[model samples]
Target: MWKIGNIYFIAAVAVIGGALFGFDISSMSAIISTQPYLCQFNQRGHDENGLCLGPTDDVQGGITAAMPGGSWLGALVSGIVSDAFGRKTSIQLGAIIWIIGSVVVCASVNIPMLAIGRVINGFSVGICSAQVPVYISEISPPSKRGRLIGFQQWAITWGILIMFFICYGSSFIPGTAAFRLPWGLQAVPAVLLFLGLVFLPESPRWLAKKDRWEQAVEVLTLIHGKGDPNSPWVIRELSEIREVVEFERANADVSYFELFTPGMINRTQVGVFTQIWSQLTGMNVMMYYITYVFTMAGLSEPGTNAVLLPSGIQFVINVVMTVPALLWMDRWGRRPTLLVGAFLMCFWLCINAGLFAVYGRAPYPGEFTSTAESMAVEGPPAKAIIAATYLFVASFAPTWGPVSWTYPPELFPLRLRGKAVALCTSANWAFNFALAYFVPAAFANITWRVYLIFATFCAAMFLHVFFMFPETANKPLEEIEEMFDDTKPGAIKYIGTPAWKTKNTRNLALRQERNETLSSEEKMGVSGEHKESAA
Candidate 1:
């Protein structure tokens, strides 16, 4: 592929931050099914054999719930930091916390220590999740914005694939130390990311917003490649930045509460709820409990190669699908790809759930007749069910997977974008925590029913996108803002009101008068400053 620009190299650095974000997510899942971790609380737990557990259920549940609960705080606090500091600083802080969390996890001797460490790691991920995408989005050209942000999703999948193999590989090593080593392996990326970020620049757009124009120019020049700092490309982007900043300045200040103001409320609602809907899709439930799902599919043991194989392969699939997502996002248009992805997920999830339900309710032909005959049934439908489950994984890899991370940042106005993105991300982590903590219980009660619930959510998401979501594909940020402005009832009401009519008439005459002084080049979309007066 042709090198797009220095931004592509910058994207490479940005993706490492994303890799750490992804690594943290899939790291815990790797050891979730291992010994000591899985069987630690089992009362009558068996060692490497069909084991029984003590109050393993209650104790582990409490511990697991604590971890994601901490994650919730991590995600919530990330917004404040990202807004107060900058995305780059916040992400760097996240790396420090991640390293600390990893060390804590590696050395943990008790449940509280483990929980605290998980909380720290969770916090790091929360910040990385929000900041990495924003940083990538700010630095990216609009033509490649979708794909650039899409890289974050891809990195996450790669992390999952790596951890899955690490777990799979370690499972054969024959001791508690074996599994513990894999958990410690997460520290590698944390260290690499920390080192990498030191050499990277902050987002030029973000710097410009803070009125650090000179710094913004330097960063933009480096990101556009070692070009003359005053070149046309550099000049063009700086001009865009000035226009955007001026536009935002004249527009009303958008505070958190102002997020609910009449003219701005719809964007806020979409920004917040789209995140809520992403979680309701039940993606996390599967991600968090894939091991347990594997167990139920007849693994019968945690330390087996077979169990780890799927885990690794799932990760590989996630990474593979991500490439296509970035390629197709702009070409396909946002709404269609997203909606189609959702619907495909719904179909796959429903089929998986139904197959599992059938297997649970009735045995198949010629299978182990003992358990089947005891209940006048047949054999375990492990193969069919596991196949369907993996298919569901593939379904999520390209569709809801990338959209969940990309959509919020894409949809909001720049003024409210940070807080709105933060809130939506918080909602996502909240659901992520809930799903991670509760999936085991959900499975114990009715595995198939749990999936059915997710399938229903996916179907609903598909409909919601069809009716409500707009096509933001390949549109400049300015045009997207105007589109959302048109969606607001009060915006329309403001335009139609008598007060608005006078302002509109006055503004029109003012625009015509101003246009009379423009240079010829300026009239042709070059060499003139542009500004939007609306906040």
Candidate 2:
């Protein structure tokens, strides 16, 4: 049967799972302020002009957060599913779930129905987001692994950009169909992803772990050797993978409890916190609720194109900026990208917070709290906040954006890769759920102070990455374990030995020596057979 043999094509097709997540993001962001969505789902009833007042702060947050809440549960179970079934199968399952959720969301008539649909969609996102990177990392060559995994983030940005425009177009339609059209369309990419997976290869490392040696070699040959099973690079990779898998099989059982053991605890911390810090950077707050942020900037009334168009620009910026990371993350290295990203994000968030604190007006005593009136700041100050937001996203798109997804999956062995990444992704969604729920209320009550909170988070994340994250760029998955093992306990243990300081030459030399030994044995066997025949 024909299957996708090209690695880049495989990465591109698989990241449609990430796009499903993007679709969910804009599905809410584009329509949350629309009259049809507000009137249909809001329990609060209509205002003086008969425009829907929308749900109260708490209800709206729940509505927005429902998907990530579902995703949190979905991520936890995704490890089990992927481990038992396979990466490609798990992603196909997620695509099917997303289709079902899109149907529910399109048909939603009330807050509960809407939340339920969003939760279902979140479950699908949870499964895909955790596993896509793992699959990509496993199949990719170590030299290009960062670039390939970075595609997941790039795909996410594309999903966000595409869906936001779709929602923007649908918003002009009459009644609930405005929101319903885009919500229903969410299944389109999920459908594409399902069909696309039929032609993609399973992860080679995953096959090796299952002891299906021939199939594993075939996959590695397809990906790395142009179909030459005897290629030196393929032989070296297979050797490294088999060595690690055999050792792991002899020594360890796959267990969640094992992740917390002393030998693994540092990796667990780095993996889990890498995701936690990604969320706490407050980038998603922009993705999930950009309209709200712009509304406070007094761009226009909540549902107007004035607000939507500018918010759309951020999506474009997100997509455009991610290209740099895709092109050069392997060269730039992960640790530096993360550290610089955090620092710049801190700088941008502080500027945004300062603008709001200085120029924004508090809500008038009788003004409706849910509308832009509650925290309006117009003219130059509002514009500066918008600029700061764009800069903040620019800071994030190339740096933490891709690195966060790429870093964690590289930290574990084949035995722990699936579950370990799921644990980390769940941390991402847990905070995603909290912030999605909290930010609306925070905006309503605390105003500019919210930006300050995230700014502080970015600062702390900078410190965390500097101390805890070693560069995982340009290192083979089987060899990354050595970096952790080599760390000695002391004041500088947190910094560890940098990944760049370790040379790939050592592994290359070892593989060369092994190849020479194998060749000598083959020649000796041939000579002995000839001697026996002559005798």
Candidate 3:
């Protein structure tokens, strides 16, 4: 709640960490398409007449999908690393790997070398995505926690937009030298992230759990300097950490398979499905084939349209929308905000699908092909559909896009958070890879069905939230532990309606109307009747 210089520094560093993941998402797509890089290299492996020679179609797909592949591995490993080495070390390692990957990509002479570089970078991004939010959540005060964690997503969107613009601007600079500049420029943030970590204190909650009281105190001092280190605020946080640790110690040592045990099952389902929902919404699909999308709408070219203006705009919109997530998160509560946003996403994607389905049929003459290339089409109607889709991207950025990342860290209990996040977040990368690898192929074959598929996913998630996602706004972390219990069947259920229930429960009606009835009953001074109703 209080504005402090230290909070900004912590947020800024966390954002830089976020940027590493974001930049990688869009940066390589530009590199893959740039003629000076991709085309000339193809010619290099050609015969005397300049024809295909090195790295066949399958090899190229592997190279392009390198980061996603590595991310899957990195995410799988992040749980052990974050839990064993701590969040700081995990992030520091990610930065170092990212820098190496950037160098490899920048200096790569062949597809294999570039793919190797991307794999290294992808590993780093995976670790960051797994650990950074956990760190942010530990350090943040609950009041501002959602918004601060939301910053990671906001930063990611900005990073993607910035990378796109850099690629766009570089493309016009007239040579391979220009394209190389953008690849090289990516190294800067990674370098900064590596350097900035020197000043950052490790998570106080993490230290307390480890029984490093002196270290935890120092970290707390860093967060709440000039204010008494032993102030009630500081003590309250320490107590919460102790309670979390105690709770962990009390639970039986459950295996991963036990994640399906009733109470725990809901969160696992939410974590896994929410991530799947994110990809199925077609965000990654749009990202992977923005150039093709633009071209399909008759916007691609030997001219300015090659720049991926629609994605670039969406990136900027995402960045702008992220600015308020931190503030509104505490104000609106996570479930209401997330549900509202998810519902809006359903509406927007469905609308975009309808528009595209209506006008995007009947491919351009001679442009339609069996191969995975944009079917160049054009007109006012086409432009309208493209415009609508870009707006859809903007909507996603602020809502499901960022909320997906923030929710998992906050919702999961401390002991299992690392493993759960690692598994769920990796699933995200897996879906990302699937989308990136198959979207072009899907579009060429399935046409507007791709958008329809996304719309269906978003709609399903909207209904799921209306029925299940709990309200976690201003409540203290300890109070929400009940939601994570394995014994409570509807622990994940929010305060809503009886019809929203997954199974029949007699209390559902009273629970839904509990608040409205309480005030009126109190106004009439019917305390006995109110007491009887609660019973």
Per-candidate RMSD, Å: 8.4, 5.1, 9.1
* Clash count per candidate: 9, 0, 2
Q: TM-score rank, highest first? A: 2, 3, 1
Alpha carbon lDDT of residue 375, candidate 3? 47
TM-score of each: 0.82, 0.91, 0.84
Instruction: Give the C-alpha lDDT of model 2.
Output: 0.85
lDDT value, residue 247 of candidate 2: 77
> Any idea how many clashes model 3 has?
2
Q: Report residue 265 deviation for candidate 2 (angstroms).
A: 0.5
Superposed by TM-score, candidate 2 places the C-alpha of residue 517 at a distance from the truth, in angstroms, of 21
Task: Compare candidates 1 and 2 on lDDT and give the better one.
Answer: 2
Per-residue alpha-carbon lDDT of candidate 3 for residues 1-535, written as tens digits (9 for 90 to 100): 2333386678778668778767777776565555566554573353443323334434545665678778878887887788777777888888888888888988888777887888998898888887888888778765566777788888788788888889878877765765678888998998888778777888776677677888787676558533346544556667777877876777656346656677577778877776777777777666656666666776654324354665577667667776666556566555566567667766766765666677665554444221344344458767776777767776677677767777777667777677778778888888877776776667667776777777778778888777666655444455455545534344543423332332322133234334433444454456567888999
Error of 1 at 475 (Å): 2.0
Tens-digit lDDT string for candidate 1 (150-196): 88788877777777677667766765665577668888887777776
Q: Write the per-residue lDDT of candidate 2 for residues 360-478, one digit (tens) a residue.
A: 88755433437433576879898898999999999999999999999999999899999999999999999999999999878877788898999999999988887767766777777
Arrange candidates, best lDDT first: 2, 3, 1
lDDT of 1 at 336: 66
